[model samples]
Target: MVHGYSGKILWVNLSNGEVKKQSLDMELAYNFLGGEGIASNILFKEVGPETDPLGPENILIFMTGAFVGTNIPCGIKTTVVSKSPLTGIYGESIFSAPLGLDLKYSGYDGLVVKGRAENPAYIWIHNDQVEVKSAKHLWGMDTFETVDAVREELHDKSISVVAIGPAGERLVKIASIISDDSRAAGRCGLGAVMGSKNLKAIACKGTGKIAVSNPERLDELRREALNIALPNTKTLREHGTAAGLIVFEQNGNLPIRNWTRGSFPEAENITGSTMTQKILVGPNPCKTCPIACGRRVRVPSGPYAMEGSGPEYETMAALGSLCYNSNLESIAKANDICNRLGIDTISTGQTIAFAMECYEKGILQDTGGVDLTWGNPDAIVKMCELIGMKQGLGAILGEGVRRASQLIGKGSEKYAIHVKGLEFPEHNPRKFKSMAVAYATSNVGANHNRGSPMLVERNLLSPELPWKEPVDGFLTKDKGRMAKVYQDLCCAVDSLGMCKFMVFWGKLPLKILTEYYGAVTGRALTFEEFMRIGERIWNIQRAFNNRMGITRKDDTLPERFLKESVNEGPAKGQIVELDVMLEEYYRERGLDEDGKPNEGKLRELGLGWVADIIHKK
Candidate 1:
């Protein structure tokens, strides 16, 4: 068992308070390849199609890649899989570093939690042993406090704990699973699934070592990754992802005022460059990640006198320009509150921004009848806490923009700005047709990670865009192909435990991937075959959603984006012709009449093995 992993799959039956461990399945390992692929395959087979997302019958799976807990670079990644409380579909959230590695070293490939606990409880995993302990005291704590309390109970500073806060306890649809200070499995309401389980935290410690078949090749790959990390790391180090804000604004891609506009008034001051110059203290890198995109910021002796995580590009757009808040300190404060309380920043900011617009239009009044004017930093700060704590109006806001808008409908649905229940990220689809296609068909709602071709299409380096000589951020055509390529490429990265940023310079081709895979598994396969597995995994997940009743009709952008024109900036008068782009996209993806995958295409991808399972119902 050279490249063979020693970790077992841990299962806990909460209803009976029974815990067991099973040897990891080598066949599943070679087929699914772990992370999203393995998680999706297991969830599809084990969880019934009609199981209620919040019910005890639904499973909560925390999985890691096979490479996790090893010396391999960026292999320390984990995935949380469950039926989403928000979308009510096969769902997952990916996180990196310490938590996954700890679980693996603790002798578990993954942990599957089923049935609700009789009372509040937390699972303690030490080496190969597992126990469900009472967590009545941990229930009321925020994420930061939860970690502190759990560490104290375990009496081991070295143990890694992934826990939820009051938001998860309250079953907020956008609640997060926070781990290792700032790392989070932050999307798709997986935290709410943990809350429904009546499980407070999972703490683990390990004394085992992970092995690789070829140490020399592993060391060689490590050297290559580190060499790439050195000079190339400056992009993330210098500006972080926030570095893209100015580039986004310059290209009219920033989502201003709930995407009613695409440009902001004070984009410069809120850009990443400004944050670095103002309050950035240092770079924060994840475990084994060469590109440290995370930034630590401290605004001592100011209106915001705290030190914590700064606003990444998404936070800056959603909280700053989207809400019209020019104060960077307020944005940083919001990020910290969301992290501490374990909430998704993008959804929180979007909900509040939607509320701000509602207030401006007289749709909502403060319970005390206070006016919520745009750019009111105090009101913004107050609402952030209010949302985190789920207090009064904050409770309604915690349901996310989709539900909140419906609860206070006065034509406000038009401003909710979400696709398939999840709020849109900072990118504006109206400005990039590829993003429009990506947003419409994303398995997890309007997420940018599924296929972020914004940089490619915009040609950030060249003044000219990709399609034509004259750059037009708002134009639409041939973007369907762009979306298709990036989606497959991104899925490959997700499967391999590689950061998507590696593709920024150029794609980390299948040759590079297969070389590494061969080093690990000793399997001789072409890059094409490795990619076929990735494509197969993607289709399997898509088929999972389709099995849950997602149809071609569900693939659509919000009406606001399709109907409303970008009323300001270089992208003025631009509206996403989503239907045209989506139609082209459907064809490009090899889907038929109603956008179901064609048997021919499925066979072409060597996915005909599952065609019967997909088309039977």
Candidate 2:
């Protein structure tokens, strides 16, 4: 018996309105583990090179980790995988929400939605039953309204719903899938894929409890996790992710004015400490999470007035520093618009910043008489609404910075900060050299969450990394080794359905994770064996991209990061030595000159099939 999983996969074909259930292969489960690992494996096998990201041929997969629906701490993350409309490659986003747990309880290990619906529709899952319901009325609703309306119609307020808003409805490439109104699977434009499939939402409810192999041991691990997480995450709990803004700004880690500036003087105005002093209501915790890094905030009697999830560090950096808008309330308001409209805040803000730069350079004309000048909070908010609704100039911007720049090409691509067609997140690779490697090699493109070695580069994570010496944040030396280890570790944690924040607070040990897996699945997994699973998953994702024509040349930073140096702040005069990092990274990753994973590495990781695919390419 498989102790951790439901041992069933729910496959929904939107084209024919058919629902099928298949038992999960135990051997596959053992190899891929769960969450992103399982999703990546499925995508690699099903989605091919010719598959259009937004076409009916593409498939969207949602998989929970083995620990999901169990008592494991911070095990509420769900992996959403597909060929991204934004990146045009293998794309995966991990989000924390109760939806994953509910899906697990619905007697399925994962949900795979394939093909396109004939009309607007939604998938409803109640244990042992599935329904493809017409979503005609819910078609035009925002994310918040969609969730409310779905819950109201179902007469189950507790039902977990993952829905896209108007941005998704309009097929915005930066669209996001919002779970429970606030939590977002925000990267790679998976929501656009949902939109292409005519899927409005997926609502799930389940009463069944997951069975564990060793309940007592699982309980013990949960207790220990709490103990480790509680004390270590006080700052996070109190300040949320915004706490790092001032520090990041000081260190030149913040991307200001669309990656042109390394620091923002107005950063303190939007810092977490300021947010707490101004509009903070409380901390919002995810299901089974102890850190409670999510912020609940209310802006009193302003245009941005209302209660909702506050901006985290990424949102703050993207909307605040990246655009040079330090108005905290305005940033929150923009965040609210993104949340409700079902758009990725990072991408939305980065696109707006890109447009602003274009406007400054006379490449893009003012749209509808709204001047998109830098530091204009009103213009930023207006653009958010426009992009969300896909109205006016927003229509062009909705396609994402990559396509938008191409449409308005007059050296516009030079100012467009992106990797693999996906816009850059708020982190600047110039500040953290290891991030250069991470941004370049990420399957989803320019995403910080894929493998953030910033912590290791700063010597933050402890019991020490496997490197010979402490890593320096500014240097490229041994960065490839540092990034490789961190990426593998991050992949393992995400597959296990554990939140990355837990790594900071809990300093979570490999032994603890292995023990938890054994306790839940009744399968003894060694640390070495588990780490190998992460490596295998990473290789599989790379293989998926390789099949789509991603080569060593594609594994590169934007020209801005490679050629431009920071003109101000602590990281002033710093330019990412991407060529230096890429060579070392390719070598350490066992990739050939063209960045294709070699046969030896694939065979070593039990991925000879992947090797075969790459070799043919």
Candidate 3:
């Protein structure tokens, strides 16, 4: 029996409504380390470059990590991997929701959904009993309503619901999947893929306890981690992810007016501090989480009165500073709409910000029926609804910044502010030089979760990493190496079915991470060995993208960051020196000048099959 994982894979064929329980391949677990790692490997093999993301060909795999149901703190995250409808390449989204926890307890490490339902459907998993049921009645419901409806229909309040809303049902490229009405798998347009498959929701309820190796050691390690991690994460716990709004504004890291401005003077007005003072109800922690960085908020009463999950830093920057809107309550309302509509707030906000810029430049004569003036809270909130509902102009913007720009061109592409098809989240690559490399080279495009060398460059991460010395944030020196380690380590962390917060923000050492793994699965990997697993997963994703025709040219930042320098604030007169870093990054990552992992590199990572596919024999 596997100690940590359930050793079972739930295979669902939505086309035929066939559900099969297969034994997990342990060898893959050793190489991939579960969660996104295993899923990425499987997706690479099962899904090809020709696969249509919103068609029946694409398979959505939800894989939890080894430490999910174990004693590891903050190890409750799950990864959803599929071909992207938005980026047209590698797609993955991570979320820490009860739905994932329920998945582990239901005796499956992974759930693979393929094919398309003839009608609206939802997967119901109750321990060993799995069924695909009609979701016709729940089809038009919002995510919040869908969750409640599923639980009511199932007659089990404890069941976890991962559902989509109108945005996803309409196949909006920026659609997100909301879990339990709070957390979201908020990237890559995977929700549209779900909509394509007619999968309305997945309600899960579990009753089994997970078995862990060296339970005593796991408990002790958990205690030690709690002691160390809790202290480091105090600020995060107190303020939520938006605490850096003012700080980022001060440092020129906040995106303002579609990334044209260097700073947001009113950043403090709509920050996590302001939210805490105004709307924050309390902490909303996930299973096995101690930091509780997730916030529960509510607008007491007003036009923007209502909420469940609050906006994090990305949403705040995307909907707040990027649109030049500083009304915290209105931002909260926008966040609520996005959450319920199952839309990616980052992309939605960026698209609207782009429209706002386009409106200013006369590229767009009208923005639907709304006046998209800068800093207009009403316009920002209205755009959120329009985009989510895909109403009028929202229909085009919901295609995402990349496609939307192409459809409405005239120097609008310059302000599209995206790498590949994915829009920039909140982070400013110009402010944090390392982020330039990280964002450009991400498999899913403009990604922050896959890796964030900026954290290290900002000295926010612990010194457990070998290159823990102080870094010159502006210099392009060693940033390549930093991005390499950052990306690889992030793969390892994501695959562990763990949230990076406690480890990254909690300042926990890498050794502790290894200890948690060892305690859970009796696999005591050294830091080097652990990183090797990450490197392997990273290689597979890169290889998959390579097979999808991604080359060195595709691995690039938006032209704005390369050509346009911010003329004011802390990052004043600064543009990302990406070429110098990319060359070094490519070398460090063992990729050729074309940015594809060399055959030698692939084979060396035990991915000879990947080499065979991506590299002509």
Candidate 4:
């Protein structure tokens, strides 16, 4: 018997509407752990280099980790992995919700979806029973409407629903999958992959309880976690993630005016403190979370008046400061639209900012009658809606900045501000030099969460990590070492279905994680063994990307970030020394000059198969 796991994987082939149960491979589970780690290994074997990202060939895997549903703090994350429609490489997104827990209780550790349906459909899983129901009438509904419709159709309000909206239905490259109306697996365009399969939503209802090895020990850990997290996350609980706006602006880390400026003077008007005063309704916490960092907000009577999930720092920076728009209400409204319409706010807002820069420079002339100007909140909201609906210029912008700039080229790629077809998040790498290495070396391009070394560069964690010494944010030396350690930790956290926020709260020590894992799974794993699993997962993902032709050249930041310097604020005259750090990073990671894992490293990590694949390629 397997502890802390259902030991079952649900395989659904849409083409023939066949559902089968595959028993979990204990050896693979032991080596890779679960969630993104196991999912990436599956993708590496099944999805070949020739597979088209948006075609029927690409497999989408939704997986839960061993710690999920065990009352572990911040253990509610679900990992969604697939070949990316946006980046055309290994893509993964994580969402915090009850969906993955419900799946685990329904007697499955993960769901592997393949092939295309004949028409629109939705998957329903209730305990041991699975059904593919026709969703013909729900095809065009937004994410909010679809969630309501699916729950109503199933006659179960308690059921969890993960659905897409018009953006995904239209196959926009930046589309997102929304869970419970507000929470989203917001990156990588996995929703477009669902759209390609004619999948509308996944609804799950399970009554079974998860099995844990030592309930008493688990209870002790739970109490310890709460004791550690509650006091440490006071600021986050009070102000939500938007509290960082002022700090980011002061530190010159916030992306302002399409990354041209280092700071936004109007930042205080739309900060987390301001949001609490103007729009905050209540705290919205995910399953089994103690911090409760999510904010539920509303805009009362205005052009942008609407009620929905409040804008986080990424959204606020993307739609607010990136375009120089200080209208907090408008940013909240844009957040609501992106959530309902199933689009990634970061990519959508960044794409609009890129277009605004082009329009200002006379490179982009026509915007289908909409004003393409900076600092215009109305135009920003309108453009977001159009992109969601795939209307007019929205259709062009919906493909993301990389493709849109390629289509409308007049030296516009330089201003596109993307790496490997994925737009950068709200943070500027020039201010935090380690962020430059993090963004460049990430398997998924330009992502902040993949492994943000800013946590260390800012010295947020106390007792300082033993692997690297603390350094100034502007310094480039030793950043590669910092990035590698953080990346491995992030991979382990993600694979274990734990929230990254736990790092800040000082609740994610390797000892506590191993204790929790031992109590949950009944297996005694050492800290080194657990960390090795994380390293193995990272290498496998890198190998998967290597098979797709990603090399040392592809591991790079945008030219604008490397060539240009920030002209204002604390980071004035600062530019990212990516090459100096990249070489050090490759050396630290045990990769060759071309960024491919060497034979010795692969053999050491027990990833010999990955080495074989890379050699054949």
What do the candidate models score in CA lDDT, each in turn?
A: 0.77, 0.88, 0.89, 0.88
TM-scores of all predicted structures: 0.93, 0.98, 0.99, 0.98
Best by lDDT: 3
Model 4 TM-score is 0.98
Writing each residue's lDDT as its tens digit, candidate 1 over 1-617 gives 73636547888988888888878787666666767777777787777677988889989988877567667666767888888887777677777747777777777778899999989999888886789999998888888788888898778887888998888888888888988677778788888889899988888888887776777887787677566545655767787878878777877888777777666768888888889999899887778766778889988876667787677788888888888888888888878888888788888888888898998888887534434677777777777777778887888888888889899988888778787888889888877777988888888788897777665666532112133342354667777766776676566657656666643542233355556766776666475566566666777777778778778998899888787887667778877888887878888887766656777777876667557777766
Residue-wise lDDT of candidate 3 within 123-153, one digit each (tens)?
9999999999999999889999999999999
Between prediction 1 and prediction 2, which has the larger lDDT?
2
Which whole-number lDDT from 0 to 100 does residue 146 have in model 1?
86
Candidate 3 Cα outliers beyond 4 Å, as residue runs: none
Model 1 TM: 0.93
What is candidate 3's local distance difference test score?
Answer: 0.89
Q: By lDDT, rank the candidates, best first.
A: 3, 2, 4, 1
Candidate 4: tens digits of C-alpha lDDT, residues 126-239:
999999999999999999999999999889898999999999999999999999968989888889999999999999987778899999999998788778778878878988
Better of 3 and 4 by lDDT: 3
Q: Write the per-residue lDDT of candidate 2 for residues 491-571, one digit (tens) a residue.
A: 888998889888655666557888999999999998888878988888889988888889988988888988899788989
RMSD of each: 3.0, 1.3, 1.0, 1.2
